[model samples]
Target: MSFNNLMIYRHPCIVKYVSSWQKNCKFYLAVEEVTPLSHVLPLLNTLQICVGLHSILKALHFLHEKASVSHNNICISSIYVTRDGSWKLGGMEYLCRYEDLSSDFLNKSRMNRYFKAVDSNEEKVFVNPTARRDFIDVYAFGVLVYEVFKSRESFDEVPNLDVFCDYCRNELQHTDPSQRPILSSILKHDFFNHEFINIHSFLIELPLKSDEEKMLFFRSLVGRLKMFNEEVVASQLGNLLLSRMVLLNGVAQETIVPFLLTPKSDEQEQTDQLFSEDTFKKYISPKLLEIISVRDAQIRLLLLNNFSNFMYMFTKEELQMYFLPELLVGIKDTNDHLVSVTLRTLADLVPVLGAATVIGGKRAKLFNDGRPMAHSNKNLPKEGTPQENEHPVVRDQILNNSISSIIDSHNLILPERSRPDGEEVETSTEEIEQSVDEDLENWDDWDLNENHSILINRLGIADIIEDSNDIAENHSNEGIKSIVNTKGDLARSKKTIADIEELDIKSQVQNNENDSFDFFHDMEPVINSSSKFLINEDNKCDVSLGIDKEVSSKLALNVNDINEEGWGDGDWD
Candidate 1:
């Protein structure tokens, strides 16, 4: 191997190093024994994919940033999944620091099929040899991501491919190195989404440097408390984070409400293990009230986004107490995004309220016509943690678009009752739909240039792109492809590299930037409630309950039918 020092390091993803000795002219490399990643193709699951990808990303990050080296070859054969299902990135034989190698050397060293990355300028792929080859890791990371998601029985079958961004099923083959988002950004991306895979663990911090560092540091503090301050740790975290989110006891607990977030109970689990009832009541609830009290559009939107996580964690009382009132308030907000997130959140909330009505006496009374008008906004110290908005910008973006907004599968209209003086009533479902259609028509007419390219407007109606998240190159990318039907537009398929090619690989989204939303279909009725439902064309992960008239019209899907699983457990990547 070129870099013998590779034997010295240790990382969870990297194979553990053991001592090696040379006998005669022959040299021996003793290391932990593990099967090749290629050896375990059939055994891999979405959870293993997340665990492995994250481990590889972290391993690459450590190698590139800390050690100033990049694994020249990051491929299936080189990597290995641990017995516990965690991935271990190996292939130290190809390790190369930022050396000023000649083009010939680079060419010989890299496997043009996957390792070689084309530069943005599109001259020669390996033009500069002196600069850090960090982007290669990014490109490789993208390729590996494709391979992991698009599995195969053997290495030959693992074809190069693209991923489905909320916008399109685009190629991961980015020709440019700089265009590839960095390791830090990649970690936070919704693409490597722990939620989607139901991995139940995600420790990726925000994409912003300051925010990422702040979160990582606070996480370190939490870790130290467990390591050294075991006695006072639990309460200490409560005092510090103002919530017991630290003592995450798989809040994907035995809890149920009117609606379910996931279709299957066993397949569902809470990864983020956040916003437990007590956590919300003591820490998150107060902050939300602060935001609701002030009513700043941007801040309120951000706060709502941040606070929206509580909905998944809400019980009947918690939903009626915190999420329902605040989210309904947000529905009245002028901003499209705010209304979008609030409404989708409301879609998730109503079932819980209904469940309360189904199971409890009049706990749903909180949701009556005389309910509160709208959600407000508040200002917390920007330097606070997730418990206190330490990195508000990243926190807000992640919470709003990715967490709250993107999953906006439905909306409802609060029908108005007749006044004793015979005053006018609230807007009917038809009228509200008409008004929404008119606004959409006006907005689309202005932005849409029909018969040209597809319109790329920020028209949100569902979850954040996700309130979401990434590119790559080299090798044959032909074969069966999976397509996510987002807006039911063929134009999307055409516009994207949905049909693959070598060049013009657009960058994959690593955040909820410039993402759009589509309108959902309405529901009839269920549970004697006036709330109608809207179902996003794409996300059918939750119950799509809706009918008409009485009983049968009552389209109340069980709250996730069985408590839908939660999000990332905040475990570090």
Candidate 2:
């Protein structure tokens, strides 16, 4: 019967009866947790007392005026305060529906021991069976107010509660139930007219209000929201603003959500923030995230547009897990504005999400992939320690060695070429001179007398002089004059060859003076020098022959030719 009455006669000011069950033959009634007003009475100030008393009056009014039932047990013990500090009436065991007096209902009786208030037969409001049932609750309501204020040392302790004190003294506690004020009349007193109390009452009845009324209320509420206590906004107004039953329009929601986010304005120094840090984390942050997660793009945009205001309130883990994933949805949204804002918001989030997760591939290896560090053979080998023998050989050495081999084989005196700058190539010159000296020293030991005739025949030099002698005898002056000019041309050719410093393989030294003796330069220096001596000694002819001067001159010119052959022509052939 008690559960039925609670469930049936529901009001915001009445205790909410949730569910009931039987387990192991034990009956369980599940309801919201609450603290009785009696438990928190000492803690109540003037404003708290007024708000609590106001909530109870509304509950009693619901019973008497609306439901036509009587809460025969209205008292401080029966009033329960929820977590948000809103007061609710809970003691319904003694409630009676006078209009429904079936036999089964009539058998229900009120237990006298539990009735906190003393009753008398003289008072019709309490005992007269035929009396108005509402009068009983109204009188009990008065007693509840009196007991609350009377608990204080003096009425002066509470300032604005004078109206409540006066009403409790004269009207509600009146002996005649007809003279006592109605619940609606008592609610109009100054004590119940506080901003916090009115806001609370409006939220309690918010569900039944028209959308237009709610919009006006919420729009007007924007400025007035900060006037209420933070605890009230956090607990009551937050849930009420978001309640689906309220059917709040988008504008109404948009208006209220910011107030919930920053419950206190910048003007208040008493507390710069109304809700504590914990309140923002456990309460405000989750609410903002929930609003962001909603599919309504406008609502998501609203939260995202003001994300900075709420983002810091969320912890790091919540930002990554809840906030980032929801934001990614906006990035993928078809709305261009939403996607743009989402990308911009993500750019701002880089510091929080980090470059690895945002710009770079997060799971990618930043450096080496832990494979053994080894050089690949695909590329040319890197420059290593330079080789010791890497320096190039001098050109002089190769040229000089080749000339030396030909000189040794042909038994000749080859001319030594100079450097490119017309300076002598000192190394090659020294090597050639050393080889010539060795050959000359070897020749000095030879038997010149025995080998002289054989050497002349072998060289074919005798044939060359015989031809020159024959030509001189036939045209002596012309031959002698042509040879003089030819000798000059030969000397000029050698000087020009040295100036150019080039090796020419087919160099032919042509002398009009003596072409026959040109091959004389091909013989070794020792052989050429000794040719005249050998001929002068071995032949023993010609002091008066008149061709001796020409013969001697021819031999001298032949030795010069042999010397020029070694170096003037570079040909190995």
Candidate 3:
């Protein structure tokens, strides 16, 4: 009968009954674990006692008035404390209905055990057990109060002793069974009245309220939740709030989350905060992880917006393994605002996820014609290998080729590929000549070799060079008359064979006309040690003639000395 009563009843102050069955001819009962009240009695202060006693009275009222069932076994040992510090009524072995209470049942089971032993003088006349059956439990509650107070030395030891004594004397301990107060009247006493107790009652009835009522209640409850400084109380409160997160509106949620997570306003009162650090780690953090795993955009966005308030509650490993992956889901969402917010959240996580994981990840390769090619070291010169200096002839040839290409590029008409059709481009000869001459002026910085065969071929310089030679010939004819006046002075001046060899020699040709032109006539005549080359009236040599001093004294060399040197080797050939 007791097991049936426990299994049938459901109340916050009652021990939560899980399931019961009989297997192998044995009875099994499962219930939520709770601590015996006697074990933690030493730890309770005045406030905790008020909170606990209120819970027990509510349980008695539930059994007596609502169910018309009498517990018949209310004692120190029957009361238990849950993890959240709320007291519960358990030991229901003597449970019976009010209609079933008779003298035989009271004498056999309830009237003898778990309370103070009755004295022989106190055993007076037996009264009608059914007339005042509820008074029996009320009288037992008076005895419970006497026993609890007797354990303390003075009123100062338990500050609310005067209140409990007044209630016991005024109602529960009345000699006439008719005069004793009922469980409902006993519950209204000042001993069970407190702010925390009222909050506990409100929470117990919260689920039955409408959404608008709950919203108003939660909004007002935020400021008062801080009064519960005990870890057990705060943890239970947090559990209640989390369980009802789906029911809460946005305004209520926003109002309560900061109170649960943010630190206390006063630093000195940190230890007295309702949601202490330990409570968060043990309960709130794991609950938050489960909450974030849900993909509802509203919940996700709310957590993200207020992430800074509670982010410290999670460890690095927890964020990395769980929270980080969940947060990244927002980035892939189709909503532009969600994606934008997710990007900002990821930026804040850079320190934890590292630069390479969050914002530093690799991007796709770019395909562009203008992209520069990567550098290569394949053509770099090797160490210890003798570096050959560039020969002036080859260097000059390369330079002239480059300059000639530039001039050609600037003067050439549009190619057929660039035009709409393969049509020939018409350009004036003067335009081509003018462009080449402008480019040649830029090369005056370097003392280049007079021979420009490579440059002439690349630039198509046949026409331009021919024109230049014609101009040079005209200038030379006029210069000869002036040179005749200085010829007498030049006849006495001696020169070496090297001076003649150093003179510049230039050749020119006309395009499409195959006519060769030379600048020999324009050059000044150079004399050697041999007097045969002197300009005189009797020996009037052609000013455009060539001279070769093949056997001069300075040019003569011994064949033996040449052979003695390595030049005689066949490798030189």
For model 1, the superposed segments whose C-alpha errors exceed 4 Å read 111-132, 152-172, 193-573
Which model is ahead, 1 or 3, in terms of TM-score? 3
How accurate locally is residue 224 in candidate 2, as Cα lDDT from 0 to 100? 79
At residue 73, candidate 1 shows an lDDT of 68
State how far residue 374 of model 2 sits from its true place (Å): 30
Arrange candidates by lDDT, descending: 3, 2, 1
Report the C-alpha lDDT of model 3 over 1-573, residue by residue, as the tens digit: 557878877787898898899999999888887899899887766556666677778888888878888777778888898765668888888888877765666678735457552212122324553365576677767776766556555565334558777778667767777787888887766665556666666677776778787677777776677655546456445556665443245665667765665534334464323465666677677768888887777767767776776777778888778878887788899988777877778777777767666655686667767755442223322211111233455334434444445344433531222211122123322343444465456434222345444333222222222233333222232222221223332232112113212221111122213545433322434323221223334433232222224213323444665444332378667
Give lDDT: candidate 1, residue 133. 62
Q: Write the per-residue lDDT of candidate 2 for residues 1-573, one digit (tens) a residue.
A: 578788899987888999988899888887787997778778766666776777788888878888888767777777888765668898787787766532233234434413535333224343445756566667677777777877676555334676677777687767677777777887887777777677767877876778788778877775676665555466555555555443236656566655555534345456434465556665556556566667877666666666766567766777887878887777887899999988877877788778565555547556876675443322312111101111123212222233233234323323333432223334534654554455433433223454332222222111112222233233322211222233333222121111111111111211134465444445523221111111223323232244445433433544444445254455745
Q: How far is candidate 2 from the true structure (C-alpha RMSD, Å)?
A: 24.5
lDDT of 1 by residue, 364-439 (tens): 3455577554321133111111022123443333333331222222222212322222111243334544543444
Model 2 shows how many backbone clashes?
8
Go through the candidates in order and give the C-alpha RMSD of each one to the true structure.
41.4, 24.5, 18.3
Estimated TM-score for each candidate: 0.32, 0.53, 0.53
Over 4 Å off, model 2: 38-45, 100-114, 121-130, 150-159, 207-216, 228-236, 242-247, 250-256, 263-305, 317-362, 365-573
Q: Largest lDDT belongs to which candidate? A: 3
For candidate 1, which ten residues in a row score worst on lDDT?
Answer: 473-482
